[model samples]
Each structure stands twice: as C-alpha cells, then as structure tokens.
Target: MDPVPLLQALIRCPSVTPADAGALSVLEAALQPLGFACTRLRFGPEGEEVENLFARRGTGSPHLCFAGHTDVVPPGDLASWTADPFAAEIRDGLVMGRGATDMKGGIAAWIAAIASLPRDLPGSLSLLITGDEEGPSVDGTVKVLSWMAENGQIPDVCVVGEPTSRAVLGDTIKIGRRGSLNAAITLHGVQGHAAYPQRADNPVHRLVRVLHRLTAQPLDSGSEWFEPSTLQVTSVDVGNPATNVIPGTARAKLNIRFNDLHSSTSLIALLRAALDAEEARYELDTVCSGESFLTSPGPFVDALVAATRAEAGVTPKLDTGGGTSDARFITRYCPVAELGAVGATMHKADESTPVEELRALARLYAGVIRRLTAG
Candidate 1:
C-alpha cells in the first residue's frame, strides 16, 4: 500500500506516449490483488494502438472514478539529469523521473489510498486510465469513455489526477479548463523570379495580412472563473531555397486557448471570414481539442473542497486556468474536477516530487474518496 514503491515501479517502465512498456501490467498486477476487476482496452488504428485500463471494485451508483494517464512526455536530455529518468531513483527525499509529479505519482498515490480503505466502504470505486494523453490523443480517454458508456461504467462524478497544485500539494483544484484549438493555414501562389514583379504573386504577403487580421483584436476579456481567450502564432514557414525567387506556398500555424465565452465552431467562422476578406486562395485546417467547460459549485465540488481542507490543511482554490486534459472529455459525461501534487518539476529535466508530499497526497486522496463515496 505504500505509494512510493508502486510509483517507482511505474516510472521504471519507460511508458512514453503510446508505448505500454509494461506500465499497465504493473498497475494491473497491483490492482488485481486488491479485488479490482481490470479491463485492458486497446483503441485506434492498427499500428497506432493506445493502451487503456478500466478497473472497478464494485457496481453501484455514486461511482467515484479516478482518471489519470500513465504515459509521459519524453525526458528531453538524459545528461541534464543527475540520475537516469527511468531509474526511479530517490535522491534527497524526492522521487525523480519523467512522471513523478505529472502524474504517475498521482496514480500511485490514489491506488495506495484505495488500498488503505475498506473494500466495502463505498458504493463503487473505479479508474479510467489512458496511455495516449501525452500524444495526439486520437485513441485515448475519448474512446474509453464511449466504451464505458456502452458498457454501463459511467461514474457519478470524476476527478482527474493532473498535477493541478501550483505551489503546494492540494492548494489548488481545477474545476474547469480553457478550450484548445489548433489552426494551420496554407496559401498558394505563383512562384517566379523576384525581378519579374508583375508575374510573381507573393503568398507570404497575403499570409502576413491574414495573420495580422486574426491578431489585430482581442478575442474577449476574461470570463467568470476563466481567463481571457488568447491566440498565439506558433510558426510560419515558406521553405524557399533562394531569396530572389518568390515562394509558391506559405504556411502558418497558430493555437487558441479560449474561455467559455466562445466555442471552436464560432472561432472557426471568425477565421474563415478573415480569410474571405483577404480574397486569397488558401486552405484552413482546424483541430479542436476540447471546448471550455466548468463544473458549478455543488455537492460534488463541495466534497472536494472540504476534503482538501481537512486533509491537506489548505482551503483549495477552485481554478479554471490551464491547458486541455482528458478532463475536458469527461466533462461531457459528468461533473469533473482535477487535483494532485505540486507541478513545479513536471516535464522538466529533473522532474520529481518530495517523498513526504507523495505520502501526504495519498492521504488526501483517501479523504476525497471517503467524502465522495460516503453517500
């Protein structure tokens, strides 16, 4: 029931992105003995299969599902670390690895908490874990939720263990998150010599004009429980070999993190109108990761706030400021919130969390499970 060793075992798997690397097997091995019925789910195209796990301890209402992902972003440079990223070494009272904080630790903590509790104490307890969270996410939580719906495994309320704390563990909880939309714009034109000013149609200039139009005004002011929407231009490429010749094609990519004041559809229309105003032939492709959503103050949220205060000795703030997560997908099925450890080192070179903090987080999660399932 000690979360540290289980977390150490999980970090040793090297389960980067879509690769299993024995991560779920480690989890299954731990859960099966604790009376959890584990179901392994493989979803997506033939070659890009994603591994997911749905483990439930009971079948009843008020199902308290703990959602998280074992897949982690790659450790960029091994030389930058004091120890191997996959070694799961404990250095100076810290667990060091790729997902030590952003969330293999969280998963291990929750499982340890569950193990400490009586098996017959709650209505139901479940876990919806996915392996595609750090990747494109085409075959992860979204598909798993759909299958859960068909198979009657939807929980009453869900909590995502997404490393939401800012300065201290359990100091902050994400009640919602901003929506994400990625756009790619490609403009085509005639390629010709620079000296032939009359023959060459410059696409770069047109693309710049379009970008200017998109960035000229603010999307909106800050919304209630959310920050102002933002549009950032990430890249612009021409791929022209020579300076004298005008490139035949120009492409630009941008991302929008929007609040609840707007949806992806409305924003896409706004983008299309801007392109139409330029009267240029271009292709606009957009991918909507998720729509902004908020879980209002209620019994479920109240239970989470109360649990954090009782267990972590802090009145957690209900925040809605972060990038997208699988929580966005869960919001469609039920009210969901996020909580976990301090994330100062997540995705960094020497990612880690304090050993004491990890143990305390397990206790805090135990409190949350008790309060949520006490009905």
Candidate 2:
C-alpha cells in the first residue's frame, strides 16, 4: 500500500483529458481489495459518456467522502518533456508525468492511507473519482453529486484532493476558490479609409474606452479567506493586416477572478452598464466557469488546522486564492475543502512530486480522517 508505487502506476496511464484509458479500472483494482464497495457512473450527452466512480464502506452517519479525479490534461509540445508524459519515469527523487503533481498523486496517496486503516474502523469511507475534470466538466462531479443525492448517499463533509498545497507540503489548505467568468465583446463601427477620420466610427476607441472603465475600478479589496477580485483582459484582436484601412469590427476577451463580493449575473450587469454608459453598438457573451464559495474558518476548518499542526508541525494557512475547480458544485451539496501535496509542478513540463512527500501526504490524509471521524 505504499503510495509511491501507486502514484507511479497512476501516472503511467495515458488518461488524457476526457479519455479514461483504464485509469478508473486501475483505481478500482486497488480499492476492491480494500473491502470497499465500488460503483461506476457515467453521465453526459447521449453519445459522450464521462467516467465517474463512487465507492463506500460501512453504513454510518458522519460519512466522510474523499473526492478527486483521475484525468490528466494533454501534454503540449512533447519535445519539452525530459520523459514521456505518460511514461511515469522516476528520476532523482520524483516521478514525472502530466497529473503527477496536479492530482493523481494526491488521489493515490489517500487510497494508500485508507488501505493502512482498519476496515472495521469507525464511521464510513467513500471515494468519488471522476475522469471529466480536465474537460468541459458538464458530465463530471456535478452529475455524480446529483446521482448521489437521488440515491441517498451524500456525505456530511467532503475533502477534495486537488493539488492545494503551496511552497511546502501541508503548508496550506484551500477553503474556497475565486469565481471565474469569461467574456467576449464585439464592437461595431463604420469601415473607411484611414485618411477619413470623421467618416468612420472607430470601434476600437469605443472598445478601449469600455475596457478602461472596467479596469479603472478595483473589483474589491478582497475577502477574509479570499483575495481581492480582479478582471484581466486576455485578448484583443481585429485580425486586420492592413495598416491604412480602419477595421469595421473590434473584439476583445476578458476573464474575471471574483470573490463573494459578486456573482456572475451581477458582474454581467456591471459590464453591460459600463458599455451602455458609452452608448456603443456592441454584442457580449459571458460564460461562467464557476461561482465563488467559502466554508469559513469554523469547526471544520479549525479541525483541519489543528490536525496539520499536530501532524506536520506547522500551522497551515487557510487560503482561497486559486482559480475554479469541481469544488464549486460540491459546495451546494455539503461543506468541502481542498488539501493535498505541494503543487510546484502542476500542469508544467516535466511535472513531478517527491517520492517521500507522496508518502507523507498519505500520512496526513490518515490524520485528517482520524480527526474528522472521531465524533
């Protein structure tokens, strides 16, 4: 039940993006022997099936669920990697793979830690693993949680094993994440020769003005467990190569990382108000990736901090500064927090985690279980 080998095995799977590639089966093989009942649930649009796993042991209240995913994003520009992205090579003291540090390692660590615990231990244990985390997420945790609710299996408190640690292992645990929204704007204007300054309505100028208004003001100073919300313009392009002609249309893309100060609906209204103030002809589309959520530093958070201090010997900081994750949907069902290993190499070339750190993370998960299930 050593986590290093388990982590290496998970990294070896080419379960890139939406593909399962036997990663789910590999986890099932390990969990079955641990005396846990495992169930596979697939949800999505008719033809596209997203893989999900929900396994539980014992029928007890205060059920503690460990939620995570087995999927890894595609490895871009493979030549940049010292080892094959799916090869799971071990060098120096780490294993290099796409999901090595981002996730799969953390999932393996928890399973190994659970394997060390007695099967007849107090309370209940369950795992909710999804393979659609790196994709559109339409058929992943959201659907699985709904299914669990219908079947009467929602746990009291859940721990998401996303790569939440920073700087040092167990140095921080995430209690929330800033909400994310993507917006695309298209401004319309009359096209004319560059020399005819008054003949053409400069849409670029209007677009610039609106952008200035949006960025001119601060979203917020930040929240207690979260950072100040900020909006960033990701792209602006007219795709015009001509230097003498005025482009008829201007387009720009922006992203917002917001705190509890606002919701997606309210922010969209804010954007529209800014554009309307300029009275410009424009079309805007907004997509909400996630909404902000916080569990606060109450009993649940206090227990986690206490466990970290006792086990890791350092007072773990509670943070809510990261981008969105599956935890957004989980918040609707029950209280949830994210705790895992150091994330120094997540989603990067030659991504990896130390072998010793992997085992230590397992021990940490064990401690969390002990504290949460103590009743």
Candidate 3:
C-alpha cells in the first residue's frame, strides 16, 4: 500500500502515449489481489491502438469511480534532469520522474488508498484508467465511457486524479474546466504588384480587419464559477517574401479558452459573423477540444470538499479553471471533480512530487471514498 514503490514501479515503465509498456499489467496485478474485476480495453484503429482499463469491485448504489491517465508526455531534453526521467528515484524525499506529478503518481496513490480500505465496502468502487489522454485522445476515456454505458458500468460519481492542487496538496479541486477552440482562417485575394494603384486586393488587410473585429470585444464579463472568455491570435501567416508584391492569400490561426457563458458553436458563429461582415472570400475551420462544463455544488461535490479538508487540512477551492482533462468526457455521465497533489512540477523538466505529498494524496482519496460512500 506504499505509493512510493508503486509510483517508482510505474515510472520505470516508460508508458508514453499509445504504448502500455506493461504499465497496465502492473496495475492489473495490484488490483486483482484486491478482488477487482479488471477488464483490458483496446481501442482505436489497428496499429495505433490505445489501452484502457475499467476495474470495479461490487455492484451497488453510489458507485464511485476514480478516473486517471497512465500515459505521460514525452520527456524533453533529458540532459536537463539530474537523473533518468524514468528512474522514479526517491531523492531527498521526492519521487522524481516524468509523470510523478502529471499523473502516474496519482494513479499509484489511488490504488494504494484502496488497499488500505476494507475488503467489503458498502458500494462499488471502480477505476477508469486510459492511456490515450496525452495523445490524440480519440480512443481514450470517451470510448471507455461509451462501453461502460452500454455495459451498465457507469459510476454514480467520478473523481479524476489529475494534479489540480496549486500551492499545496488538496488546496484546489477542479469542479469544471473551460472549453478550447482552435480556428484556422484563410483569406484569398488577387495577387498583383505593390506599386499598382487599384489592380489587386490585399488579403492581409482584409484578414487584419476580421481579426480586429473578433478581438475587439470580450466574449463576456465572466460567468459565475468561471472566468471571462478570451480570444488570442496564435499565428498570422503571409508567405510572401517580396515586399514589392501583394500576397495572394493570408492565413491566421486563433485559440479561444472560453467559459460556460459560451460554447464552441456560439463562438464559431461569432467568428463567422465577423468574417461575413468583411464581405471577403475566406475559409474557416475549427476544432473544439472540449465544451465548458460545471459540476454544480451538491452532495457529491460537498463530499470531496469535506474529505480534502479533513485529510489534507486545507479547505479546497472549488475551481473551474485550467485546460481540459478526460473529466470533460466523464461529465456527460455523472458529476465529476478533480483532486490530487500540487501540480507545480507537472509537464516540466525534472518533474516530481514529495513522497509525503503522494502518501497524503492517498489518504485524501481514502477519505473521499469513505465520505462518498458513507451514505
């Protein structure tokens, strides 16, 4: 039940996205002894399959599920680390590894917490672990949830073990996340000499006008439990090298991290309206990573808050900020919240978490399990 060794074992696997590297096997071995019925789910296309697991230990009400990803982002610039990125070394009380905080540590902590509990809890306890969260995400939790729904395995409430805490462990529990949208706009125009008086139209000028219109106004002042929407122009491209010639086409890319006050659909309409106002020939393409969702305060969320306060001795703020996680997919089924160790080191070189913090997270999760199922 010591999360340190479990975390070290996981960090040793090099289970980067789309590759299990026996990490799931290690987890299965641990869960099987706990009487968990583990199912290995392989999804996605051939040759690029994703590994997922859904393990449950009972069939009763108030089914509580823990969701997390075993995958870790690739270690960049390994020379910067004091040790091997996959070493999972416990140096000076820190579990140093690529995913020590980004997640594998959270997964280890949850499994350890479950081990510390009784063999016969009142309600079902389950885990939805996916390996595609760091990759394309086309074959991860979203697919697993679909299978769970078809098989009648969806949990009543779910806790995502993402590193949501900021300054200290359990200080922040993510109640929701803002939606993300990426748009690529291409404006076409007739090419001609820059010296020409009125021979050609300038697409760059038109694109700038469109962009100004989009960025001129704030999406909203900020909604309850969320922040104001933001639109940022990420890239503007005009490949013309000659200053003497006007470009034939201009391209710009923008990203919006919007709150619950707007959705991808509404924002896209707003963009199109601005483009249409220019009366120019253009093409717009967009991809929405996730729509904003909030798990309103209720019994399930209140239980998480109380457990965090009791176990970590910190009153966690119910936040709806930050980028998206797989919790976005789980929100469709049941109320979901995120809590784990402080994320100060996640996705950074020499990522790590204090060993004690990892253990404390286990205790916090244990408290969450108890409070959630106590009813």
Candidate 4:
C-alpha cells in the first residue's frame, strides 16, 4: 500500500485528459484487494467518452468521500522533457511525469492512506474519480454525482485532492474557489477598400471600445473569503491579411475569474449592456465553468486544519484563491475543501514531486481520515 509504487504505476499510464489508458484499471486492481466495491461509469456522447469510477468500503452515515481526477493535461513538446513524460522516472529524489503533482500523485497518496485504515472502522468511505477534469468536463464528476444522487450515495463531506498548496505540503487548504466565465465576442461590420473610409464601418473600433468598458473597472474590491474578481482579454483577431481592406468582422475572447459578488448570469447581463451601449451589431457567447462557492469555517474545516498542524507542523491557510477546480461542482452537493502537494510544477514540462513529500502527503491524508472518523 505504499504510495510510491502506486504513484509510479499510475504515472506510467498515458491517460492524458479524456483518455483512460488503463489508469482506472490500475486503481481498481489496487482497491479490489482491499475490500472496496468498485463501479466503472462511462458517460458522455459516443465520440467523447469519459470514464469515471465510484468505489466504497462501507455503507453507513458520516460518509467521507475523497474526490479527484486520474487525468493529466497533455505533455507539451515531449522533446523538452528530461525523461519520458509517462515513464514515472525516479531520480534526484523526485518522481517526474505529467501528473506527478497536478493530480494522479494526490490520488495515489489518498488510496494509500485508505489502505492503512481498518476495513470495518468507518461509517462509509468512497472515492469519486473522473478522467475528464482536464478535458471539456461535460462527462466527468458532474455526471457521476448525478448518478450518485439517483442511487442515494451522497457523502456527508468531501475532500478534493487538487494541488492547492503553494510552497509546502499542507500549507494551504482551499476553502473555496472563484468561479470562471469565458466569453467570445464577434462584431459584424461592412468590408470596404481603404480608400472608401466613409463606406466601411470599422468594427475594430467598436470592439476596442467594448473591451475598454469591460476592463476599465474592477469587478469587486474583495470578498470576505475570496479575492477580487478579474477579467483578461485573451485574444483579439480581425483575420485581415490585406493592408488595403477593412475587415468585415472582429472577434475577441475574454476570461473572468469572479468572486461571490457576481454570478455568471449577472456578468453576462453586464456584458450585454456594454455591447448595447456601443451600438454595434454583435454576437456574444459565454460559457460558465463554475459559480463561486465557499464552505464557511466550521467543524469540517477545523478538523482539516488540526490534522495539518499535527502532521505537517504548519498552520494551514484557509484560502479561496486559485483557478476553478472540480470542488466547484462538488460544492452544490456537500461542503468541500482542497488540500494536496505543492503545485509549483504542475502543468510544466518536467512536472514532478519529491518522493519524501509524497510520503508526507500520504501521512497527512491518513491523519485527516483519522480525525474525521474517530468516534
């Protein structure tokens, strides 16, 4: 049940994003021998299939669910890596690979912790794992949770094993996360020769004005447990190749990380109003990844803090800073928090984590389970 070997086995799978690549099967083999009943859930349309797993050891109240993903982002430019991205190479006291820290390693640590616990000691213990966290996310935890709700398998509390720690293991516990909204705007206009300035309605000018309105002011000062909201214009393109012709359309894309003060609906309305004031014909598309959520400090959070102090000797910060995570989806069902290894190298080329740190994280998770389930 040692996490190192398990993590090595998992890292060997090239399970990037939506591909399973036998990652879940590896986990299943590890869990079945430990008395857990495992269920494989395949969801989404035929073309974009997502594999998920739900496993449980007991059937009673006070169920503590550990949620995570087995998927990793694509290893960009493999030639840039020091070793094979899927080799799970161990050197310099670290395990290097695509998911060493961003998540697969965290999952391995938690499973190892679970293995150390008494099989009959808990009211309930379950794992909700998905392979779509790094993909479009249409067919991952969100679908599995719906299935769990239908089957009456909701847990009392949940812990998401995302890489939330910034500097040291257990130094941070993300009590919540800001919501994410992505918007694409396309402004329509007439195309004309440069000589006919009066005939061509310049859509670029109108688009620039719209972007100015969106970024001119702060979304909010700051929330009680959240940071100030932010909006960034990621791309602006006219796609005009000729110097003599004014483009017919201009498009710009924006991403907003918002706090509790605003919801996606509210922000969309604000954007629409801005476009209306510009008096330009335009098409806008907005996708809300998740809504802002917070699990206020209480018994569950206190237990996590206590466990971290005992196991890692650091007073963990109750933070709401970070990009959106699956915890955003889990918030609708139960109180959830995020705690895991330092994420300094998560999605980078040589993604890695020290073997000692991985062992420490396993111990920390064990302590968390012990504290929460103790009678």
Candidate 5:
C-alpha cells in the first residue's frame, strides 16, 4: 500500500468539482481489499449530481473518522502546466497534478496509513469523502453528515485532511476556521443622460457609500483563538457601456471571513441596517458557507500534536487562519481538526507534492491513527 501508486491513481482522475470521474471507485478498490465496507452516496439534484463515499472498518467505540473530498478545483489554463493536469506525472521527485496537494494526495496518504495498521486493532475507523468541496459545497460533506446523523454513523472525533501546513508537512494543525459569507447588493435608481444629472438618481454613489460603511471599521479585534474578521469587496459593477448615461442599477459583491464573534445572521442584520440608513431601494442576497468553529485544546488535539512531533519533527502550531473547509460542517457533529501537506501550490498550475513528503505524510497519519485509537 505504498502511497505513491495510490496517489498516482487518484490524481489521474479528472474528477474536477462535482464530477466523480471514477475517483471514488479507485479509492473503493483499494479500501475493500483492506476489509472496509464501502457505501456510495449520490446526493443533490439530478442535473448537478455529486458522488460521495463512506467506508468503515470495525464497529465499536472511539470511532475516528477521516474526512476529505476527492474532487479538485478546475485546472486553469492547462496549457501553462508542465504536464497533463491529470497525468500524475512524477517529475523532479514530485507528483504533479490538479489535486496533488489540495487533497487527493492527502486522502491517498491516509488510506495507505490505514493499510499499514494491524487488522485486529482499533474500535472503529471510517472515511467520509465527498465530491463537492471545491464547488458550491451544498451537496457534499454537509449532506453526507446529515445522512450519517440519521443512520447513527457519527464518529467520536474527526480529522479533515485539508492542506493546512503552510511551509512543511505537519507544521500546522487548523483547530478551527473562520466562517464565510458572500453578499450581493443591487441598488435601483433612475437612468438618465449625463446632461440631465439632476434627474438621474445615482445608485453607484449610494452603493459606494454602503460599501464604505461596511469596510470602514474592523469586524472585531482578534478573538482569543482566531484572527480578526475581514470583509472584502469582491466586485462592483454598473454594466453600463454608455459614457453619457447614468446607470439605473449598480451591483456589488462582498465576501466576509468572520470569527466566532459574529454569525452570518448577525452580520446580515448589520448589513441591512447600513442599507436602511442610506434610504435607497435595494435588493440584497447573502449566502453563508459555514459558521466559525473551534475544537478547544484537549486530549484529541494533544494526541495529534504528539504524533506530528514524533513523526514529522515539527511542533505543530494550532491555527485558525484559512478559508472555510469541510471541517466547518463536521464541527457541528464532532470535534474536528485539519492536518495535511504544505498547501503552497494547491489550486495553482503545476500543483505538486514531493514523493518523499507524501510518504512522510502517510507515516504522520499512521501515527495519528495509532495514537488516537490506542487503548
């Protein structure tokens, strides 16, 4: 169960976002021979089908679930890649492809680690994998988690194999992540020729003022275990091609990465207040991807830190800085943390991981599994 071949197999699948592309089947073949009972879960509407897999070995207490996504983000501008994005090319001692680090490689490492464990050891072990982490994420881990809850498949603790290390493998363990909220605002006004400035109500002016109010102040001073929240204006568009006409509508999009101090509902209320003060007719839509969560330092985190120090020789730092991950969804069900390879290249052209690093990560994961399940 060398991770190299398994990672190569996974990377070869062009399972970008919602597409399965046989990625789960490849994982199933590998896990089945190792005594895992695998279940394929297909979720979402028919047109946007997403495939997920849940597999388990043993059926006792202290179930340790490994969660991740098999899908990779789209390989942008393939012509710029040194090799085929799905080739899993081994060059300069690195495995190169779309998902080499963003996650498929991490999944391979964990599976290989499981294969290394003694057959009779452990209370329970399971994998909750999905194909929608890189997309809208509506039909992936969230749905599988609901199914697990209904069927009593929830584990005692969970580890998400997202790329959390910033510089080297095991250097960081994400104890939590900030929540993400996306907002779109459209301001309605009257369109008029530039010569008739007094007749045209300028929605752009109003929209800019609203955006300024949102960004003018910090969301919060840094939280105890998390960084300060942030909001960025992603886009502001009038879509007016005519230089002489004032646009009738102005639209702006915003993305906020917030700490536990604020929930999406609270933030939405704050935004509404701002819009109300402007006295402008407008429409607003907000979508919350996840709420902020933290698994406070305790025995589970202690086990992971100890294992990482022993196996990778890094005193792993507990961090909460990063974009939202599936762990956000899992946090609702169980204490969860994130650990994996360095993510410096994830989602970029020529995304890759060194063979040596991949093997090392397998050993680290093995140590984590061994420590957490030890009697």
Candidate 6:
C-alpha cells in the first residue's frame, strides 16, 4: 500500500484543535476501501460540536483497538515554514506539515498496516479517531469511550498511535503517562494604605510563604520508570497597577507534573495543609488528567517490543515519561500502549517525518497486527 499518498492526503487538511477539516473523512475513505465499517459519533453539550469516529473490521473475538487524533496544533508564524503548513510538501525526502510527525503520519501507517492484512483476517480490529485531543479534550475520547461502553464495543486491548518514538522510529513505546494537575490559588487580603503596614493583612507575604513551602521540598525522590515529581509556579498575577496600595487579592497558578509516587488526592491534601499552616483565607481549584498508570510489561507490551525488533531492527524501551495523551482515557478500558514514528518536530513551524520512516512504520504496524492475531 502507498502510505505516503495517504499521509499527504491527511496532512493537507488543516484540522487544528476541535476542528474536523475533512481529516476524519479522509481516514474513513481509506478504511472503507479496506472493508472497515465506519460510524461517526458526535457528543457534547448543546450547541457545541465534537466529532469522533469509531470504525471496525472483522467479526470475531480478541478485539484490538487503535486510537488517535486527527487534530494538529496551530502552525505558529507561517513565515518561518519552508512551505505552507498544510500543503503537505515533500522536500528533501521529508513529509513536512503541522501534523506530519505528531500524528497524521501514524494514522496513515496504521491504515496501510491493516490494509496489508489478509482480506479474511481473524478476530476484530477497530479505530477510535478523535478531533479534540489537543484542545480542552472534554468531548473527544471521553465521550467515545462512554459510547463504546454503553454499546458493548469495548476492545480487549488498545494501541494508541501517538508519536512515542524518541531518537528513532521504534526506540520507545510508552506504557503509561504521568498525570497532570493545574491549579489556581487566590489569597484574600486587606486593601490598606501603604503608609499603615501594621493594619493590613498582606496576601502577597502569605502567598509567598505558601509558594515557598510548596516548592522548597521535593515531591519525591523518583519512581522506577518515572522521573522525580515537579511543581512549577507558572504565574503569580496581582494585576495591581498602583504599588502604593495593598491589593485585596493575590493570585497564582501552579502546574504540577507528578509521577506515581503521589496521587492527586494526596497532592491536594498537601496543598490544604500548607494553607492551614499559613492561616490565610484562600480558595483553589484543581483539574486532574489521568493519574500515573503502568501496564507491567505484560503480553501487550511484549508484543510491541517483538514487532519493533522484527520490523524496525531495534528494541523499544518501555517508558512512562511524557505529557498526558488520550492514552490516559484508554487505560481505563484495557491495557494500552503508545508506539509510533519519530516525533522530532510535532507542533512546530516545519514539522516533518522522513518518507522512508513512514513506510517503515507501516511495515512495523503490520507486523504488530500479525503477531497479535497469530495465536
């Protein structure tokens, strides 16, 4: 199968976060040509549209699911690119586009891989393509997973086609991702004249103590497969124009990238305790996305490593170090792992993937499928 043409066709669509831009249609067209029955599902609040696709082939046991997104991040500063970001230019043997390495290429590879399978393949195969992975992500995979559960379409294993390869095309396959929690805290203080410092409760001083306490100590020494937990103060915004007046409120936002050493609840508890020590009137809100998960290098991960060695001539490292992806949502349903092409330039001005590697990925994925269904 010609994977380049399919990759080019996918990259040509400017489906930047939360937009379809004909990306899914291109995929459906390819899958339908290969005998996969397609279904388009949309779920979100009234007046909001979130597009998703669930396609399946064969009718038997041992179902295998492939999941990914068609959305690309914004092509920053179009002038910096050698060619148009969505033109899908093939220059110097590299396929250049916004989503070239991050994903469009991976989806194309999987399509080609399944196309190469026998026409009467055993077991079942499916695809879960979402359009909201790079956005707030409320309406894409989460909704589709629910729909699958309600409709009794959950698969036995899931392979997320995220760009997990680091230095090479098959150097790493991620078994899990560290969870992310973002929070904003506001400490209330008294607005008093600067001349009378003793009368006013200074929120800045209180918040400084709180932040220092939070950051002074490390969250952990580090887990086996994960790095040490980290919490960074992203922003401390007072928005106060007058320096002479003590502000009524001091606000700050922190971004925490934590590992399996701590749970979201435990971190929240620590935050509350810190606030209690400060005795400051404060309020906080937290958003948690996927606590750390591990698949334990079981049969699913072993198959992936074997396929990479056979097809790509390299042994892949089982990793859990990266920002969160849709794998977080898939982990709830079954054992899931992420393996794909080299992501040297995913969401940049001149994102690219070599043409040769794209074909190699197709072969690698085909081998994975064969190994999965051989038994």
lDDT of 6 by residue, 1-375 (tens): 879999999989999988898998999899998989999988787767888999998767678899999988999898899888999999999998989988989999999999887977678999999999999889999999999999889988889999999998899999888888888999898988888978888898899999999999998988988888899999998888997888889999998889888888999898888878888789998989778887778788899999999999999988988799998988888989999998879887799999999999999999998877654
Candidate 5 structure quality by residue, lDDT tens digits, 186-228: 9898899889989999888889899999999998998899999
Each prediction's whole-model lDDT (CA): 0.94, 0.89, 0.93, 0.93, 0.94, 0.90
Query: Which lDDT tens digits does candidate 3 get at residues 58-132?
Result: 999879999999999999998888979998888999999998998999999999999999977788999999999
Which regions of candidate 6 are displaced past 4 Å?
none
Model 6 TM-score (2 dp): 0.98
lDDT of 4 by residue, 6-62 (tens): 999999999998899999999999999988899999998887789999999888878
After superposition on all CA atoms, what RMSD does each candidate show versus the true structure? 1.5, 1.4, 0.8, 1.4, 1.5, 1.1
Candidate 2 segments exceeding 4 Å error = none
Clashing pairs in 5: none
Stretches of candidate 1 exceeding 4 Å from the true structure: none
Residue 152 CA error for candidate 6 (Å)?
Answer: 1.3
> Residues 312-367, candidate 1, lDDT per residue (tens digit)?
99999999997889999999999999999999999999999899999999999999
TM-scores of the models, in the order given: 0.96, 0.96, 0.99, 0.96, 0.96, 0.98
> Which stretch of 10 consecutive residues in model 1 shows the poorest summed lDDT?
273-282
**lDDT for each residue of candidate 2 in 63-115, tens digit (9 for 90 to 100):** 99999999988889999999998888889988889899879999999999898
Candidate 2 has what TM-score? 0.96
